[model samples]
Each structure stands twice: as structure tokens, then as C-alpha cells.
Target chain A: MSENTTYREAVKRAIHKAMKEDERVFLMGEDVGRYGGSYAVSMGFLEEFGSERIIDTPLCESGFTGAGIGAAVNGMRPIVEIMTINFSFLALDQIINSASKLLYMSGGQFNVPIVIRMATGGGNQLGAQHSHSLEGWYAHVPGLKVLTPATVQDAYDMVGLALDHPDPILIFENSNLYNTKGELDTNATPLPIGKAKIHREGKDLTLLTYGVNLLKALKAHERLAKEGIDVEVIDLRSLRPLDDEAIMASVKKTHRVMIVDEGWKSGSISAEIMARINEQAFYELDAPMVRVCSAEVPFPYAEHLERAAMPQVDEIVAMAHKVMEES
Target chain B: MSEFIMPSLGADMESAVLMEWKIKEGDKVKKGDIIAEVETSKGVIEIEIFEDGIVEKLLVEPETECKVGTPLAIIHSVSERINISPAAKKRAKELGVDLEKLASQTKGTINLSQVEATDEKTETKAPTTDGMRQAIARAMSKSNTEIPHYYLSTSINMTAALKWLEELNSQRPIGERILPAALLIHAIVLALKKVPQLNGFWQNDTQEIISEINPGIAIALRKGGLITPAILNTQEMNLNETMHSLDDLITRTRTGKLKGGEMTQQTITITNLGDLGIESVFGVIYPPQVAIVGIGNIMDVPWAENDMLCARKVVKVTLAGDHRATDGRIGAQFLDKLDKILQKPEELL
Candidate 1:
């Protein structure tokens, strides 16, 4: 069965289903109980699951995140929400050093089965403080798995997959995608984590993207198709433990790549993907890899400046054309 | 007993200042040992002793300027000599092996095998020469500006020559065997006799077909530069004689023992880059000379003979002829004659 839903509603339905099925699963974060959620994802969940399951916390990121890790290690599956990715820096020590390492540090005696979710990306004009996509930083950590859900189906699926994983996992939900509506197939086969999905296939160039940029790349591909420049669109659903087989297959077919990422250009996820392509499929490439990424600057407060800093649909189209012209 | 004179270090050098004596009177010195330093226009160069001797007298004083052949020192030859077999000595001369350098490397009497090993070890390219680097740069720049060269090439099937060489080497001793380069040089001289149009110079606004066939052989120095010294009067020699002269020329070129006339008397040049694994080489004419012949790597290639396809060893030969000295027809005829000569390898001997 399929139903029309926004990314926020699909995510809320997935969390509600996990709460109904597992008794050990609980939700905890600041203002998660009485105020519903910062984005109203869990409205009225405090009354339905009661205060025991929908627990609230004080305004301390590190303390609450560490407590969630401790509870996860003991035998409970806790879903910890860190409001925005920019504020997650306050709990960096617990996320990378503590939660990410506890399984191996304890000699495999204890596993921190916790899922940390945060709103990422910079299209909402939340100013420099609240709008930052720092998922690539967490992807750099070895022991952690990172997932960026771009579609409503993935938003419903990846959250349940992360909760079932034995180690720590971080889900970056782009704030701009919260209200974007799409059809969600509830009975579709679940996709395994760390596998990329191809939205459209072509012979000219491979367009690799994730998060909100996936939609922008799809739009760019439609425009390029009209101009007779066929482009293959691939959504890298998971960042860490990247699907190298999928990437190499597309690269060998098209012999050209254009990575569109919302993160900044330097040391960003696009750089990592480009490096992997060079290492594994360098001889298959006909031209150098191209990328359209966010400008290396703090997110601006003004709407026009913010739009200019992030990658747009027109830029992705232009970069794809550039790759075709080079080949 | 011999007098060590001021050696001509380069074609352009005529005089240098005696900088300092590293050894005094009565000091015993072996071969390849540096005994003095001279200040040339290039830089301070350390001069090595060519013989094992005891210094009898220092003829030139420090800071005194001297011409190219002026006596710099006098030494008495040592009786305790490094012995080498007569066969090995003959082989070394033909191979142009530096016996003094070979003597410094071994303790016992040297044999033919040891001399061959030394020749094989010195084939690789090494570091650089500061002055030779600048000289090459200036000459190449001049050649690029003045010479309008026309290049032509052809592939020679070497099935007959290689088979003949293998059969000939099987019957002879190791010391008497001739290399493929020697055979190629012999054929080139014979071909030049037929097409005298290429064996000459472009001077005084006309082509000068010199009677003497002094073909310059481009030898790359171990210290990272190149020098082309001619094997004078190849038209008067046979295959074995040409091979011996080539070896002696190479040895003297490396040891700084070249005569002044060999540097400026080249009528035509030949560069064999086959040992470096190059597939084809089109060399630039080293000015004054009208043409340069280049030989590339020989490898097995497919051939069609009498409507049958088979593999035959083949090599690519190229000629870079100055447009003013010769036309394409003459260059093509020369290559055709060279191919015919190589086919009858027995006639070359």
C-alpha cells in the first residue's frame, strides 16, 4: 500500500511503529515530551506512550547524550534527538569518543545500540548558528555509520534499520526536506544500509548525490535530458562505508562523474567520493571528476545570500554539461 | 716514465690555470687517482692519473696559466704493475675498456670475462656534468634554428643477419665475437660508399662530399651528458677492425683521452638507441654534418614473405638529412642499400 506523506510524517510513522513493536525502545531529548518536538514530529506522543517511554531531559547536550549511550549499553534502545546538527558539537566527545568506541573499548562485552538524529543542511535560513551540514565530520569517524535519507521511503526505512544495528549510527535529516511531499510505499522491500540507489540511468555522466541535493540532481537530469545530454542520477543513501561497487559500476559505464553535495567543497563528502573513484576506477575515467558543492563559507542569515551559498539545480545542470563537454 | 700534459677537456677549451697540486714529489700514486686540480673556464676540474707511477717532479706551479699540450708534471713508472692477460688486453682495447679503472677495481690479474663484466656494468646512465649540460643546450638550440631537416625511416627485416651472427659467434671464442653494432657500422660504411651524397657536410653555401668516411658515434657519458667522437677512416677497415676501433673510441671518450681532431672531424653521425629500448629515433643533425642515422630497437614483428605470414626480427632505421645537402630520393636510396647490405651479412665481414 502507498500513501502520500512528507519526510517529517514518514519519519514520525517509522518511530511510532518501532515504539509499538519493541518494549525496550524509548525516546529522550530536550523538549521531546511536553513540547512534542522542535519540528513537531512527535506531537502527542507523550500521552500515547506515556512519560516512561517519551521521556524529557534538561538543556544539556553532552549529559543527555551520554545518558542515552549508558542506557543503550545496559539493554534499552534509546533514540536520542539533538535538535540541530550545529548544537551536536556540544556532545562531540560522547558521540565520537564514548558511544562510537564503547563496543570495541569494552572488548566486545558491551555494545552501544543507539540512533542519533539531527536536522542538517542550510536552505531554511536558520543563520550561521543553526544551519550547518556536519554529517561528513561524523562520517570521518571510523566506528560510526552515517545515513542521509533523501526520499520519503528512505525516511521511513533507514530509521528502523539504524535502530536494529548493534553499533552507533547517525541519521542526518535535511531540514528543507521535512515538508517536501512524496509517495511512500509502506510494503516495499527494505533496502540494506550502505547501498546506493539509482534514481535514473543514462550513458553520458554519473551524478552522485544525497540528502536534498538528490532532488536537485533529479531536476537537473530532467533539464539535461531535454538538451540530449543523458545523465545518470545516483543517491548515496549512506555516506560512511560507501557503496564502492555501485560507484565503480556507474563510473565504468559512463566514464565521467559529477558529484553534487550540500557540504562545503574542502574536506567534504564530495572529496572523499572523488578520491575513491580515482583509487578504484581511475583508468575507466575519460575526464576528471567534477563537483558542485556549497561555497566554503558560514551559512548567511539573508535568504538571497543563503540561496547563493548552497548548490542549486542550475549549477548541477551546468556542471553536468561541463563533464559532458570535457569527455 | 711519462710526462702528464695539460689535457684538452673540451672541444672549445685551449688553456687553463694550474690551481693546486694534491700530491708532492716522490708520492706513489695508482691509476684513477686524482693528483692535481686545474681551473678552466667551466670550473675547477680534478685531474686523474692515467698510469701507476711515483711523482718525479711538478713541472707547472700553482696559479700559472698553461696552453693545451704544456707539460704539467713528470712521473717514474712503477715496476709493480697490475697484470692482465694478453687476450684480455686485446679484448679491452677492442671494447674500449678503461684498463686503469679496471685495475683499480680488481686485486688479481684481469681476464677476458672480468673485462666483459666491467663493460656491461657501465651501460646505465648516471648523474650529470655541469659544463657539458650547458654545451648541449647551446648546440641543440642552434641546430633547431639553423637546420631544416627532413626525416625518413624504413623497417629492415633482420632474419638473415641475426641467423648469420648467431652461427658465426657459435664457432668463435668469446673474445673474438663481434657485436651487432659493429656489423651495422660496417654496413653503414659500405652503403655510404655507394651513396656518397649523405656522407659529407653543408658548408660555404654548398654540399661538401668529403672522401673520408669519419662517422661520429654518439656516446652517452656515465656522468649524464653526450659526446660524439668520430671513428676516423672507417672506409679503410673491415668488420672486426671497425668493432675494435669502436671499443677503443668508447673507452678513450669516457677516460678523457680523446685526440682533438676526433671531436671536429665527423662527416656524418650515427646514433644507436636500441639498447635504451626505444622503438624509433629521429636524431637532429649535429651541425656542419649534413645527416644523422638513427637505429631503433630490434624486436620480433610479423612479416609476409612469398604469401606466407611469419615472425621475423625487424629494426627501424631513420635518416635526418639536411634539406640543403640532400633530397628524399638520396636518403631513400641509402636506406635501401643499407637494407641490402645487411641481408648479405657474410659480405660485410
Candidate 2:
């Protein structure tokens, strides 16, 4: 079935399919059952999958998320959904202390096959607490596999892939992408989580990034190509075990890099990428590495300020020009 | 299925000696599995396959020399059939022709150009060999015979450098001791910036200046001959970083655990004969790369300063460059910069 759906809908379909395929698979989150999910991702999931599989919890993110992990440790595949990334901070103790470290701390005996999904990024003028991108923070933890499903296709397939992996995986979904529609081939296969995908191929500069920033980078790449500045855009679908091989290979050919992330610049995922490039392919670069990141400030309340606070296509293009220049 | 050809380890290496086989005929092998060990002019290298297959036949015996691009076994792979010409493969790719489409029309070898010409088919054969040493032999011979090489040597005052190294190492633990070669490498990297023309490759009748200064460091193996694997991006590294990297590189090179890029990514070379007690050496430029910087053992030499002759520790530096890419003037500038760098070896740290 050739289908076109929003990113959030694709996510719902994946959860439904996973639950149908396996008896032990279940989803638990705030408003996921009777309330049909905060974002309406699981609108009818409660009726079809029933309360046993589609669980609705109170406002305690820590309590429900911990229950999901405990269930996962006991051989049940639990998909924990956080209403928003801001609330994931409330359960940071459970996610960091137990979910991520269980396998290593337990001598590889307890492989936490838990998938945590959360709405991330800023666009809806939600207050600072609700409108922040914190996927970069999760990527720092060693035992967790962090993912960003930018496209509808990725949103559709990555959930299943993450569920199949014998490790804890945190998928950060951009709140802005929930309404973005794209074609999803019904027969599409799951891509390996650790590998990156090249959205565009060029030879002059490589735009390394993930999540919804991929679209802005692609647009910038196309604009750059018009001026004969071929820009290669790589979507780093995997965050924790960053695909350095793909990043380095692109940098080797391009001789320049521009990392665009929704996170803050200092100590951000972009910083990690620049450090990796410095360690692996510092000599391959002809110019200094550049980062197009969200401004290091609390999410602004005003729309204009919000637009100015985040990474845009023009900023990426300008940064590309700056780094790709001959000194 | 998949033909495990002799890998081109280095730009200069064309073949290797099939010293031993870890897996014989009928043994199943997986990707990244060490199937054989081959000794090149550099050293014995453990060869790993990139595909899973069953060893159908052992094409060449152990200890036999072979050439570059020579295959070593007829492995019945879980993958598709081999022997598809690259040109035909490209054509097939352009037309979206896959293995399934060709399997019905052809048998054995599949060549797009010859498909309609005849029903003639080519047999699958793996031409295995001990070609690494031979490859190096052929490359170096070609470089010596065809390329116009110009050599330049200079005596550098290493008094301050040696003194600096001794003082720096005295404060650190013995395991963290820095070698003199690190200083030399640092100085050469800085010199390369000033004299950039000689620090790259001469390819396809053109001269290209490489941005990063990855120095191919010659490491002597236990058996004989030597392999010059690259220590990448030396320009950005500090003297301390250089020292640590050199330690790791030398250790890995001797252990035959060299990364693939290390073997093939030399933009220029650094040959230090100081450890072997050589006073000076006029070394060869590793092919593809255009230049090499050589350092000799430091010795006490008489120096004249302020009209007084005093004994100073001095080391000889030699530059071997491809004359086609650069002239003696460029080589002289590099040596001059090197000498100046050595005077302030403290800055390298």
C-alpha cells in the first residue's frame, strides 16, 4: 500500500504493527489510552490494542517510564511515550540511572529492549519548558542508542528497528514534523539504526545533521549547488553511536563541514561531531569546521524571536560560504 | 562468488608473499575474518575478507609470490556470481540490470558486450600470489627509473632541541618520554606549510597539493624490509600529541594491525634513521607522494658563535623531492624553515 501520512501518524502505525506482531509488546504514556495521546498519536490505540497493551498513566513521567523499563527487564517490550521532551527531564533519573546503564552494570545479562519516544524541538510557541530540544543531552549517555526520525518514512520504520535492537533506544521526534506529510512505501524495510543516510550528495562541503534540521540543510545544499558550491547533506539518523565512517568519508571528499543541530552550540551534538572530525579527519579539511545551531538561550516566547533563535536555511548557507571559502 | 584479490596495502606495494593460510579449502569464512597472512617488503600482513563465503578451492600455494590484482581463492559466496566486467557492470547499472535479469540469459561469466557475440563463457579462477613485496619492488623501481628525484641535505643545530627534550622528559614519567623524532616530525610539518608544493601527490600528469600533512613513517618489521604507514594530520598535533601518536603508530605497525587508511593515505613521508645510528640518509620518496624528510643521528659538532668555536649537538636533515612537482628552491626553503623550527623546538610543544 502506497500511503501518505504525517510523521506522527506513521509513528502510530508502527506502534500498532509492533503490538499486533508480538503479544508482549505494549505502549504506556500520559493520555495514550482514553485521552488518545497528548499529540493524538495514539488516538484510537486504546480501543483496538485495549488497555492492557495501550496503557494510560497519570502525570508522573518518572513513575510510568520506570514501570516500562521494569517491564522491559522482565522480557516485555514496552514502548514508553513521554508527552513532551521537557517532561522527559522529570524521568531523567529513571532513564539515566536504570534504563541506559542496566545492561553494562548487569554484565550484559539485562538487555533493556525498551523504546522511549518523546516529542522534541520548538515551533509552536510553547513555553520554555515545553519548547526545548534536548536530544543532544541523551546522546551523551554511553549505553543508550539515541535516534531522530526526521522524515515520515523514518518515523514509520525506526520504531520497529529500535524495538528489535537488544538495547535501550530513545527516539526524539520533532514536534514540528508531526504535521509534515510524506509518502511511505508500505513495504519499506527497516534501516540499520547506527548508519546514517545521505539525503543529498555533493563534493564541496558536507552538512552533517539529523532530525528536522535535515530539510533546512537540504534546501541550503540545493541553493549552494546553484552557485557551483556542491554541498553534501548527511542525515545522521543515529546519534549515540554516531556514524563517523559516513561523516569522515563525506568530509574526505568535501574538505569542509557544517553541522546543523537544533541544540545549543556549546557542548552540543554539533560540538561532538566537530571533535570527532578533528580526531579522525582533521587533515582532510581545507577550512575550519562550522556549526549552525540553536542560539544558546531559553526558547523565546515571540514568534520573530523564536525564528531568530533557531537554525535557518539562510544561516546554514552563510556558514557554508564562510567555511568553504579560501583564506 | 566473491574473489578475494590481493589487496593493495600501500601505493608502492603491488604484491605480497603468501606466508601462511589461516583457512584452507572447504573452510567457511565470514567477513572481516583473517583468512591468510602475506609478507610484503614492509612485513607480514594478516589479510581479512570483506564477504562471507566457503573456500571452494585454494588457487595458490603458501609462500608463492604474486602480482597486484591477483586473486587467491575460488570462494563460493552467498552473494552473486563474479567475473562481471566493470564496464558492463556500469552499463547494467545505467539500464538498471540486476543479477536476476542476467542469470536467466547467461551462464558462468557475464559480459554485456560479448552477450550477443558468442555463447563463449569464461571460467572462474582466483589468481593468488605473494605480490606485496613484488608490488613494492615494481613501484620503487618505477619511481627510481622514471621520476626525476632531487636530493638536498643540511646539518641542523640540535643542541637546543635535545636539551629541551631532556628537560621535558625529566619531569614526566618514563613511559611518557618523548622521542627526538617527534620534534623532527613537528618541525617538518611546520616546514611543510611554508614549502607546501612538495607536500602532496603527482597524479594523472598533474601536481596536487594536499591540505593535511600525513607523514608516512617507515617502520622496520621483525622479518626484513619495511612498511611506511602514515601518521595522519601531523600539522594540527602538538609535540606531546605527536609523541603519543608516534608511540601508538610504531606499536601498531609492528603488530600488523595497521588501519587500511594508514597504509594508503601518505601525502608525504618521514624517514628517521637516527634510532639505527645512521649519521645521515638520502631516502627515497614513497610513490604517489612527492616528498620525504629524513633525519639522522645527532652528533657533537664544532660550531662558531661570537667568533668562538664550541661543540654543539647537531643532526643532519635530508630532503628528497620529486623534481617534476617542485625545484631545489622549494626544497631549500623547507629545510630552512626546518632549521628555524628546530631552534625553537620549545614552541612545538
Strongest candidate by DockQ: 2
TM-score of chain B of 2: 0.63
Judge candidate 1 at residue A212 and give its lDDT.
93
- Candidate 1, superposed: residue stretches over 4 Å from native: B1-349
Summarize candidate 1's per-residue lDDT along A1-327 as a digit string, tens digits: 999999999999989999999998999998889999887788889999999999898888999999999999999999999888988999999999999999899999999999998889888878988889889888999889999999999999988999999999999999889998998987888799999999999988899999999999999999999999989999999999799999999987787799998888899889999999989987566666899988888999899999999999999888887766654
TM-score of chain A of each: 0.98, 0.97
**Model 1 chain B lowest lDDT segment of ten:** B122-131
Candidate 1 docking: what grade?
Answer: incorrect
Estimate how well candidate 2 is docked, as a DockQ score. Answer: 0.01
- Candidate 1, DockQ score (0 to 1): 0.00
Question: Weakest 10 consecutive residues, lDDT, candidate 1 chain A?
Answer: A318-327
**TM-score of each model, paired residue for residue:** 0.50, 0.49
Question: Candidate 1, clashing residue pairs?
Answer: B95-B247, B96-B247
With candidate 1 superimposed using the best TM-score fit, by how many Å does residue A275's alpha carbon deviate from the native? 0.6
